[model samples]
Target: MIGRPLILTTLVVAVLAVAALFVVPRLGGATAEASDLNLEAQPRLGASDAPVQIVVFEDYLCPACGQFAETVFPRLEREFVETGDAALYHKNFVVIGPESERVAHVGECVFREDEAAFWEFKRVAYRSQEGLNERRALDLVSEYLPGVDAEAVRTCAAEDLALEAVRSDVGTAQALGLRGTPSVLVDGSEVTATYAAVRTAVEAALAAR
Candidate 1:
C-alpha cells in the first residue's frame, strides 16, 4: 500500500512537470524569432544598442492602443527609452479597417519625411481619433505636424506608396502570434500590455542581459 501511494505521487509530479513545460511557453516563456520581427525600417526610440528591445504592435484605430500611447507609452519612453535601457520599436497590426491602413500609410510617410515628426503625428492621430477618416486624418496631419511635408504624406497615402511597409508590419505581428492591438514584447517575449507589466519586463530583461 505504501509503495502504490508513493508511485501515484511520483506520477502526479511528473505529469505536472510536463504540463508546466507546455504551459509556461504559452505564457511568455518562449521567445519569438528575431528574423520574423522584421525590425528593419521600423520606427524606433532610444539608443540603437540598448540592451532590451521592446516591440509594440498597435493599430491606429484601436482605442486601447490610444490609451496606451497617451498613458503607458510616455512612462516607458521616459523610464526606459530615454535612459537607453531599452529600445521601443513600433509596428502596425492594422486590425481595424481600410481607414486604419491608410492612417498607417500616412504615418509611414511621415516617418520617411521626418522621423521626429512621426511621433508628433502619432500623438495627433490618437488625439483626433474620434470620427477619423482619410480626409480628416490627412487634415490633422497637415494641421499638427508642421515639420512633416503634409502634401507629400497626402500623396503617399493616396497612392498607397507605403502600403507594403504597413503590410509587412502586419505580417510581422501575425507571425509573432499577437492577437490584439497594444501588444508589448520585451526582449522578444510578450508581456501584459500595461506600464507596470512592461516596466517589470524591461527590468527583468535588463537584468538577464
Candidate 2:
C-alpha cells in the first residue's frame, strides 16, 4: 500500500510499513495468454471463466491499500466478482519491511489452517493498519483469526516457510515492473491505478467479454 504523500515520505526513512508491487509473468502463472486463467493464487472471489480478470498487488501495511479494501474492493466484489463478470486475484508484493512479510506470513498460515479465516485475517490486517508497524500488525492477527492459536500464529509468522510465500510475491511484482501499491491489471493490461480508472477498466473488460 502506498501511503499518502506526507506519510509516505516520513515512513520512507523510518522503515516501518510496507509497499505493494505487481509483476506479470513472462511464461508461467497468470500471464498474457488467454489460457492462463490461473485462479490458484487467490480463490476467494471471481470466476475462472469470467471475462475480466483483475490482478491486484497489495501490501497489508499500505494505507492506500486499506483505502482500496474499504472502497474499491467492495464495489468490485459486489458489482463484478460476485456476479461472475470478473475474477480478482490477490498477490503479495512486500515493499514495506520484515514486518510486512510477517503479516503476509500470518495470512498464509491462516490460509493453510483455514481458508475462510484467511480472508478474515486480510480484513483485520487492513482494518488495524492505522498507526501500527509490522510487529504490532503481526500481533493483531489473532484478533481476527477465530479459534486460532495465537502463539502458533506468531511463531509461524516469524518463520521462513510462511515468509517464502511473501518473497515469491515480491519476485513476481518486480518482474511485472509494479511501481506502487494498489496497482491493477485488467485482462493483460495495467491500467488500474485510480478508483475511477479501475472501475471503468473492469466494466469495459466485462462488457467486452
Candidate 3:
C-alpha cells in the first residue's frame, strides 16, 4: 500500500511538470517572440525591408493613445520610418468601450480600401477624439479622408466587415498579456511608450543588427 501511494504521487508530479511546460510559455515566453505577431495584411509605415520592426498597440478612444499619435508619432515618422531604419505597424487593443470597437472597425475598413488614407483617418480620429462617438468618427473619416470611399467605409463599419481584423489585433494584444493602451514594442521587446525610449530601442536594435 505504501509503495502504491508513493507511485501515484510521483505520477501526479510528472503530469504537473508536463502541463507547466506548455502553460508557462503561453503566459510569458511568447511575449519575446515577434514571429508570434500576426502582421499579415496589416497597415505598415516605412520600407518593408527595414532592419527593425516597431509595433504600436493602441485604442482609438484612449486619450494617451491620442497624445502619442499627435506628439510622438511625427518624430518617429521623420526620423525612423522615413529613413528606412524601421517599419512601424499599428495594432488595436480596444479596451475603452463600444465606441472604441466601432472606431477600430472603421479604421480597419479604411486600411483595407486605401492604406494611405488610413493614416489620415487615424489623424482625424485623434484630432477630434474628445466626445467622439461612432457617428462622429465615421463623419470625420468622410470629411478628412477625401481619398477614401466614404460610403464604402460607412457601409463596411455598419456591416462590421472589418471586425475580424480588429479582433485579430485584440487577440494578439491579449496573447502578449498587455493590459493597457499605447504599448509599444520594438524588435519584439516591450518598451516605454515615449519617443525617447522608442528611439533608444530602435537605435539599439539597429546597432545589434
Candidate 4:
C-alpha cells in the first residue's frame, strides 16, 4: 500500500541525511565514526588473547605520539602488554606529510618482517625523530632491526603493498573518528591516548573480566 511518490520522498530524505552526516563532522575538523575497523592484521604486541585491547592511532612524525611512546609505553609494556593482561596495537594514522607516510609504510614492512621488531622500530622512531627524514628513518630502522635488509626494505617500503598497508591504517583511523595522533581506543571506545588512561581502562577491563 506504499505510494510511489511517498517511497521516492523517503529515499531522498534518507540520502540527504546520510550526506549531511558525512559533511557535518568534517567541517569541525572531526570525523564520523569509521566504518569496518579491522584490527586483526594490524601490528600488535602482547598476547593475542589478552582480555583488553589497546589500539593506538598515531603518526610517526607526531610529537604527541612520541611523548606517549617515551613517557607511557614502557610502563604500559611492563604493566599490561608484557604481563599478558592486555595487547597493544599500533595503527598508522599518517597525517603529518611525506616523511610521516614514508615511515609508516616502512613500519608496515618492519612489522611484516618481524612482529617483535615492530615495537623497537616504534621506540627508535619516536626517540630520534628530530630528523624525520625518510632516509634517516630507513637508517634508524636498519639500526634497530639489524637482521633486516635495508635495501630490501627500501624496495618493499616503496612498493604498493607498503603503501596500501599505511593507507588502510589511515582509513581505519578516520573511520574510528580519530581527530589527532596518539588516539587510544579501548574495546572500540575512544580513550585518551595516555599512560594513565590506558592503564586505568586496562585494569578496569581486566577486573570486569
Candidate No. with top lDDT: 3
Model 1 TM-score (2 dp): 0.85
- Candidate 2, 23: how far from true, in Å? 21
Q: Rank candidates by lDDT, best first.
A: 3, 1, 4, 2
TM-score of 2: 0.74
Alpha-carbon error at 85 in model 4, in Å?
Answer: 0.7
Candidate 2 lDDT over residue span 81-183, tens digit each: 8887888777787777767776777777676666666777777888888765556655676665666666776667666456766677677677767767777
Residue 54: error of model 3 in Å? 0.6
Stretches > 4 Å off in candidate 3: 1-32
lDDT for predicted candidate 4 compared with the true structure: 0.79
lDDT of 4 by residue, 1-209 (tens): 89999999999999999999999876633322323556678888887788878778889899998898888878888888878888888889977887898888888888778777877888888888887767777788777789776677777876745788888888877766688888887766777777887778778888887
How far in Å is the alpha carbon of 73 misplaced in model 4?
A: 1.0
List, residue by residue over 118-149, the lDDT tens digit for candidate 1.
Answer: 88888889988888777888898889987778
TM for every model, in the order presented, reads 0.85, 0.74, 0.84, 0.80
Residue 68 Cα positional deviation in candidate 4, in Å, after optimal superposition: 0.4
lDDT of 3: 0.88
RMSD (CA, Å), candidate 4 to true, equals 8.4
lDDT of 3 by residue, 66-169 (tens): 99999999999999999999999899999999889888989999998999998888888999999988899889988888888999999999899999999999
Q: What lDDT, from 0 to 1, does candidate 2 have?
A: 0.70
